[model samples]
Target: MIKIITKVTLAVLLLAVSVSKAQNFQGQAFYKSKTNMDGSLKIESSSMTEEMKQKFMESMKKEFEKEYILTFNKSESVYEEEQKLDAPEPSAGGMMIKMENSNDGKIYKNIKDKVSITEEEFFGKEFLITDSLSTYQWKIEGESKKIGEYTCYKATYTIPVSEKEKEEYANFKNKQTDSKTQFLMMDEPKEQLISVWYTPEIPISNGPGEYWGLPGLILEASFDKTVVLCSKLILNPKDKLIIKVPKTGKKVTKSEYESLVQKQMELMNSQRGDGKDGIRIEVHR
Candidate 1:
C-alpha cells in the first residue's frame, strides 16, 4: 500500500508540472480582412504580446468575443458596389472560443449570437460556404520582424478567381430574380488577397477570423485592407477567466445563415414601408 501511494504521488506531481508549463505564458493577437480583384476575401492575424502571457490568457476569451462592426466608405470602394456600403455586413460570421489550462482543466468559452435571417438554429450546421471561395497557398517566408515590440514573421497568400468561377457566379445571380433566399454571390474578384504576420514566440495556435495553426502567436493580420486588431494584450492575470457559451440565439451554418438573412431581406424589401420585419417561428423537440 505504501509503495503504491508513493508512485501515485510522483505521477500527480509530474502531471502538475507539465500543465503549469503550458499555461505559463500568454500574448495578444490582431487580425484583418481584405478583398482581392477576383471576388474573394483574404485574412491576416498576428500575435503581439512580449512579457505578459497570463493576463492575456485570462481576459482574451472575453475580449475576442466582442464584435467589431465594419462599414466600407463609398469613396474607398475598389469596385463601384464595394464602395456603396449599405449596412454593417459580417466579416467573421460568429465565433466559439474554448480555453483550457489542461486537458481537463476549467474551460472558458463564449458563443455570440449571429443575426438570424430565419428562425432556424445554427449550432451544429456545417457552413454552406466552401474554402474554395478563395484559392491561395501561403508559406512562412523570411526572417521575423518586430511589430509593437513582439517579433513577427511574414506569410503571404494570393487568391485568384478564374473564368470557370465567373460562369458559376452568373448562374447564382439568375436564381435571385424572384427567389426568397439569398445565396452567396460573387460579383467580382479583383481584390482578394490575405497576408499574415505571426510569431511562434508565444507557442499557441489560434487567432481571429480563420487564421490558426501557426507555430507562434499572430500579432497583426490583414485581409485585403480590412483590419482586425488586438488593441491590447495582457499577461499573468491574478484571476482565471470563466466563460459560458450562450444558448440564446438560433444556430445555422455560415452559408445557410447567410441564405436565411437574404430571404428576410427580400421579404422586407417586398413589404417596403409596411413595417413587418419581426416574425417568430419556434421548433419544439
Candidate 2:
C-alpha cells in the first residue's frame, strides 16, 4: 500500500509539471493603428487654399497609419513598433510632425507584479519611466463581436482629461482665427471614452500599448481619435520569448515623466518666440 501510494503521488507531481509547462505559453500579436486627421486639419490656418489643405491632409494621413508588434506571455508583454525606413521629405508648408503613437518603445508590463517599465526617448535623451500598472475599472458589457477569427466581448472605460490636455485644447481653441475651427475644437470631448473588444479565447489579461486588465487578450481598442486593431496573432511559436525590463535612461514615475516633458516643451516654445503655431504635441499609447 505504501509503494502504491508513493507511485500515485509521483505521477500526480509529474502531471502538475506538465500542466505548468503547457500554461507557460508565449505568442506574438501584430497590431495596426490609425488616427483620425479630419479634425486636426480643420484647426489649420484658414488662409490656406483647399488644394494645399488637401495635400497636407494626405501627407498627415500616411503618418497616422502605423504597424506594431506585441510579444507576450500569460503575465508579461513587450510592445514596440516595427521600424521603418524614412520616407521622402514633405512639400513646402507640410511640416513633418512628430506625433506619438501606440508603439513608442520597449513597454514592459508584468501583470502578476502590477508594474510597468516604459523606455521613452525625448529630444535625443532616453528615459526609463517606471510606475505601477494602471488598473482600469472596465465595465464589461454583454455585447459581443468578432475581430478577425476571434470572438470578443465589449468593454468600456472613461479617462479624464488632464490639466495639460485642457490647457493644450484651450490654447488651440484660442489660436483658431476661424469660427469653424473654434467650434470644432469646442466640440471635442473633455473626457475620452475608451472602448475595447477582448477575446476570452486567448485567456490572457493582456493588450497592446498601455491597456490591460481585461479578462482576455484585447483584439481591438479605440480612444479619442485613435484606433488600434490586432491584424495577426501567433500562439505558442517555437521561438521562446525573452521578457526583460528596460534598464537604461533616467528613471522616473509617470507623473514625473510628464512633468519633465512639459518643461522641455515649454522651454522649446519659449526659445521659438512663443509662437502659437509652433507645434501642437500630444502623446498617446
Q: Which candidate tops lDDT?
A: 2
lDDT (0-100) at residue 89 of candidate 2? 63
* Candidate 1 structure quality by residue, lDDT tens digits, 196-251: 77766656654444444456655666764345554445443455432222233444
Per-residue lDDT tens digits for candidate 2, residues 47-144, read 45667666666766777788888899888899988787977767426665454422376889999899999998887788899999998999988899
The per-model lDDT (C-alpha) reads: 0.40, 0.77
Off by over 4 Å in 1: 1-19, 24-137, 159-168, 171-186, 265-285
TM-score of each: 0.46, 0.77
- Candidate 2 residue runs with Cα over 4 Å from true position: 1-18, 43-55, 86-95, 100-103, 162-189, 271-285
